[model samples]
Target: MKPRALMFTLFGEYIQHYGNEVWIGSLIQMMSHFGISESSIRGAALRMVQQEFFEVRKIGNNSYYSLTPKGKRTMTDGFIRVYSLKNYKWDGYWRILTYSVPEEKRELRNQIRKELSLMGFGLISHGTWASPNPVEQQVMELIRDYHLDPYVILFTSSSIVSHSHEQLIKRGWDFAQIAKEYDRFIDTYQRIYEEFQRRAWNNELSDRECFIERTKLVHEYRSFFFMDPSFPHDLLPDNWSGTKARELFFNVHQLLAVPAIRYFETLFESAPDRELQLNREKAINPFIGMI
Candidate 1:
């Protein structure tokens, strides 16, 4: 994985629980397990700071980093979606978003498209996107955030003249490819889960091993957020593999949780600002007890 992406995974899954801050040395030590060089970690940290995802402070010879408010909000929103078990019920109305950003602001248009895709909207045609999920409020927020209110229009419609719902879905997304990816995820993790279960039963797994495995598990599974729009069950293809993949992910995650937390706390307690971290209320893992 790219060091930058891994940093987000680390902060979201681990560091946020311990005051949402970490000494640079502590971060380097943790990232070492993934074979990331100290220089690379520092470089990634600096880039994140530039992107407003992190705030850094110097203390004597060392530096500490913490998530900015924007970063925290982003991580919180992501985690909510990642761990959500709510089966979205389609209301039979499609939310359509069409934008006509000026050519002078091409970058802004690209950003709007990226945000729409991340929010599960799929492009149905040039400058037009749609989602069966109710996300009008989110689209409005995006519009206001980008000051694109004049360039964008949103609509809710229950009818399409040219295509049926299934046809629209096919035009907007490659479900066949998505299904193949889900199959791969299920196949890979099912074997890992079986092996981990055996090791756990045999008392052969180390706390550090559990931590590594759990982090890797979450990191790998988290990619589905970008790949899967998480359509309602009724809309998914028959015998979709994503359902089985999710179950496997949660099962393995729960199996690794206790030892993973133990290992993380061991590192966290040794940080230079341990007292401050200890005094802060711990945030619960969203996946805990949700399986």
Candidate 2:
């Protein structure tokens, strides 16, 4: 898994499975379940602490940890991403029914509409909505939770397509003429992948550094859609295997460290550009001094 995803996974497990409190052994055991080493787990914990997402308590030689409010926020964000990446929650319905309500109720309707839309509802008609998926039980719960009325049943229909415009934008999957942009995205993806792979091998990265790197990649990937917000979600084609993009991302993430390190190596071998030359020397200065 990518570092960012892993961080979210670990954080989510802590918040959901375990109580808020954890210790080094608990942390190690949790990571071991995921096949990560104790040292790496400790590193991740320290990084989280630095980010103010976790608080560490020292009791003699052992340290206990718990999520700070910031940590909870991090977990919340991670949970959303994890859901996006692991879309098993989806029930294949993507259609929606929409209609205008009384002006007084429009605000309530809009709120429900936005929430339902995020869950992938398509608007088929005014005041009528359908989900291309069988609405998850959670959806029904949310409606009840929000205290929506029986008249709102139209919002839960199965006749509308589910891949609504907002879902595509939120998932950063919205694109038009991907064929034309394919080359550009491929190049950027390959370059960044290679750069990150190299960073992995050296094991030189501090846990915080690794986390930041992974976060940046996710942001960059998401930014692709942000650049062209005008693209219609309906026109964007989607592959049904909603799980594939995440699988590919994890594979690419592992492969990225190599290129990252190689790019650094090339920088040192060739005199870099002006700004880069300064940075190269700064990076090497300590090692050179040691020699």
Candidate 3:
């Protein structure tokens, strides 16, 4: 994993549990298990500050790093998207996007297209893309950021009269490929699930095991945000594997949480606001939807 990504995962998956700020020394130590060098971690932390993902707070001689407001918002949204579930009940509407970047600004065109794609928009035709979810805020943010407001037009449609729903879905999305990813996710975790079930009575998962397994599961499952458009049941194909995969994800995450919480809580003891943070985790854990 890239140092930058690992940094964010550290905040989202662990440090956020210990309150927003962590001593830089402690942060480096936490990442040591992943084989990241201290220098590399420091470099990444500095870059994250420059990029506005983190900010430093000083208490005397030592420096502690915490997610900036931007970082906190993004991480919260990301956690909800990655873990709470990929599928949201769809409203019967389509967010249609049409844009015409000048040929002279071809680079800008590519940039906009790439950003929209990352937000789950699928191309309908050249210069036209669509998403089932609302994209107004994200789209406008991009337009403003790139100064492409004059080139873009966005609209929402309650229904499409001419095209069949299946046609739109098939044309816009690669369900076959997504199903393959779901298969891979299920296969990866199914063994873990079986092992946990087999050892149900033993409760043998160590705190370290829990931390490793849970992090790996989270890191792997987070990829779904890039792959899934999260269309409702009607839009997806029959027997979509993502559904089954999500079920397995929830199960394995909860099973690991039992021991993982034990391990991470030990680290939080030194955090000055640790008690406040632990209470928040109690509230947020439900939102992690550990069913």
Indicate which candidate wins on lDDT.
1
Off by over 4 Å in 3: 85-88, 99-115, 135-152, 160-163, 268-276, 280-291
Compared with the true structure, the alpha-carbon lDDT of candidate 1 equals 0.80
Judged by whole-model lDDT over C-alpha atoms, candidate 2 comes out at 0.47
State the displacement of the C-alpha of residue 113, model 1, in Å, after optimal TM-score superposition: 2.9
By lDDT rank, best first, the candidates go 1, 3, 2
Q: Which scores higher on TM-score, 1 or 2? A: 1
Candidate 2 lDDT by residue in tens digits, 73-121: 5454333433343233334334434444567877777766655554445
lDDT of 3: 0.74
- Between candidates 1 and 2, the one scoring higher on lDDT is 1
Residue by residue across 26-103, what tens digits does model 1's lDDT show?
888888888999999999999989877799887778888988865675565556567777766677898898889889
> Which RMSD does model 1 reach against the true structure?
2.9
The candidate 1 region of ten consecutive residues with least summed lDDT is 277-286
TM-score comparison, 2 vs 3, better candidate: 3
What order do you get sorting by TM-score, best first? 1, 3, 2
Candidate 3, 219-284: lDDT as tens digits: 777767666776666677889898898889878877777677676655542335334445445423
RMSD of each: 2.9, 15.6, 3.6
Backbone-clash count (model 2): 39
